[model samples]
Target: MIEIAVSALLGAVLGTWPMYQHDPARTGRTSPSLVYTNQPNVVWKTYIPGSPSVPIAGADSSVYVVTQGGYLHKIHAQTGTLIWSFPIGGACWGIPALNPQEDTVYCTWAYDKKRWWQGHVYSVRSSSGSQNWEIILPGGGSWTGNHLAVDQTGVLYVVDCSNPDGMVNAINPDGTFKWSVPVPDVGGEEDLFALSVDEARAHLITGGWNSERRVICLSTSDGSHLWSVWTGSATGISACVDPSSGTVYHPGSDGILRAISSDGNPIWSANLSVVSTPALSRDGSMIYCPGSNAFYAVNSTDGSVAWSKPIGSSSSPAVDGNGNVIVPSSDGHLYLLSGSSGNTLWDVLVTANPLSHIACAGWEDRIWIFVTANDTVYGLSALPVEAKENLPEGFGVEFKSAGKSIYLFMPNDAQVSLAIYDAPGRLVQRLYDGVLSSGGHTFNPTLEAKGVYMAVLRYQGGMKSLKVIR
Candidate 1:
């Protein structure tokens, strides 16, 4: 018999959200095999200069954040410490992608040269923030938002709108071109081109500003035009490719969530008021969508509406393996919705004023939800989505483990008492008992014996407890 701890089982697969919305397919969830158990805490909110993009989680749990100023920063995920920073170029940029096999990061930066935007993609070493190689984007285009993607084979797919045309360029790992396909009705100075690649089916999907073909499927191998489809929506949209079935779930501007096969066939369209990319479940059983003033969870099989909650509209949401939806709303609140009931289990205010650019990534038991506001990056957490599911609203409690101490966090000020009790209900030690202020507080109390203990926290709103296995 294999005696594996829950923590060990949770980390069976490396929990790395190395790109925006989790992966190149924009699924916005961690590995389908992972199950998170750590109590999500307000780990750390570090400030970085320039307009920061949503960070990518490296396989080692280190976060890589690139700013619009063309600077790359490596942050310690658990402590939110700035490990290193590398400047690419002082120009606007987009979310970066990670090539896991090569331990390399691919990011795009754009600069206006004589009123024309010239773009360059750089390959940086993930560990030391050193440049491996870089190549100028052909025809001079700007890459922004979710326009960048990388597959398992280290092939980079990016949308390049060079003046009068929008073309998807495939770049090899060695700073060479594989192929570039022209996407009609998508060429613009600043068009929103959503690029996603499904490696299993060898399909690459692109959508943006093209009423003629709202979605185009291409070959991931050699950039062949496989198929294209026109959804009713005219504006740009993104498609979430399901790894299990190669089903493409696209949320269009027409407020409909449509499921299309990789072969460019429409499976079904469900009107759920969704306008962002859908976050498919780990099991591919549900599609979570962020709509206007509400969040929708639809049954994946028949497009039946499972449940909906009025959580307000949000940036495209990211889900954990447990299906807990992490929504960074336009109102500057990052919410975690229950997978089953579509209810708000936890929420945090990332900023006061949202210029409307927010995204999140999940890694292991701890999920990293970040918002880039006012040229600064703010990263936050989820309170044990699986372990502490019954935590009430408003009075949320989060905790973290430092070197030799466990830090208890309070979302707001409250009269709190936290103590450690042995497995037999004997009081071991009192860590803290006072008016706890907002933010994290150290609890390095004398915990002599180690087996199973309970950290009970009593506060004004209510009492919450955590099981601690020392």
Candidate 2:
């Protein structure tokens, strides 16, 4: 096993490039995949038509994003090409839900006319940019809540806040009504919170305060209230349900993180100033939550603090396949930390004020990072470990070790620094720190310790390292 792992690592260093392959016809992903890695293969990026500020939704190898201009775009996941786009003729607030089984995509749209707000739900075919059916929702007010949840059978549950008659409705794949239930506190000013479907439990979960229960679980089949529980005074915090463990984790508005059983029983509550939805590890071991100016890694089993690191104001963190947690901060850097110890592995500067959550896809060594800045969408790939010394027609450095001496090649006259560290990141020697001419240089630092070491070349906004045996 040890030999196999080492062989794999060496193979990665030799640039075993994974092919760019994906099937957009695959079923929609209800949640992110368990496979994520530091190896980001940024395939492509394209500017969307309108402002797509919300998180992008995916299913069947296609990404669906609705712009505030009410235009729904179907994009190819692999190539970032616009497969098709359709105008909604109103405003789109949140993400769209895709139903692969029905070959349909569902979204909410609203428009104001003559002092009355009109809301409509549209179902479009996923394969072609064709409208299937449109259903007018029951709401006279102007604001349509950005809540849309779907089940396995293509049944969609949506929320409509229309004055004193707020409602939750169940719509079938054919745009016919299944049922409708009244929502509490219809005329209040609270945000319409999130809606999630627990398919295994056959329940719809959401948070509220004006209702009989703070947290309510309704029947997904008929929009009937199943059971409700109030965790605390906090409202509008979304709940994430773990099917395998049958546990729901949600953040409280009053600086509390509460874990509840599927049966509405409290499992554990931790008082942390959580601000975003918690992300669960693929193995259900740890939960990563973002707080104000910090990110916390908590044990999923007992809500205990595993590790915490101070980042700038950040969006929700994401877990990659290699157990590395990804946190995008307001400081224009995306921080990748070791999942086990919360140690910083690499932090790459992306764009300024990246408050939107990063979307990750693919498996194993080919994971891709999809991020949207203020107006542009960026596709970022993980840095390859292989040594490709072809220096892109600019200032660069290459490190080579032969016998007891180290050979360094600099492309231009630039300031450079060399350092040696052990396998565990302990500094062993500080060799040189000064300007070197654009030529080859040699340094023979005595190896006082008998272990594996790394030689680093730092110069001009870039750095490269090579592993050496002493």
Best by lDDT: 1
Candidate 1, residue 267: lDDT: 89
Query: What's the TM for model 2?
Result: 0.68
| Every model's TM-score | 0.72, 0.68
C-alpha RMSD for every candidate: 12.2, 14.9
| Local accuracy of candidate 1 as per-residue lDDT tens digits, 1-470 | 11112233233112456666766777777543223334344557777878677666765667777886778888876677898887888564577878755669888777776766777888988878899998877765554334577775678887776656667788888888988767666666646667677654333333344424467787777777787777756545567888667788887777888888867899899987887777877567889888877888899888998998776664677766456776767677777688777877766676675523334444433455556666666666654343334543224576545555666778888888777654223357888888988997877756654344455555665444444555
Query: Model 2: residues >4 Å from true position, as ranges?
Result: 1-34, 41-44, 55-61, 139-142, 186-191, 200-213, 232-234, 363-366, 382-470
lDDT of each: 0.66, 0.60
Largest TM-score belongs to which candidate? Answer: 1
Please estimate how well model 1 matches the true structure, expressed as its whole-model Cα lDDT.
0.66
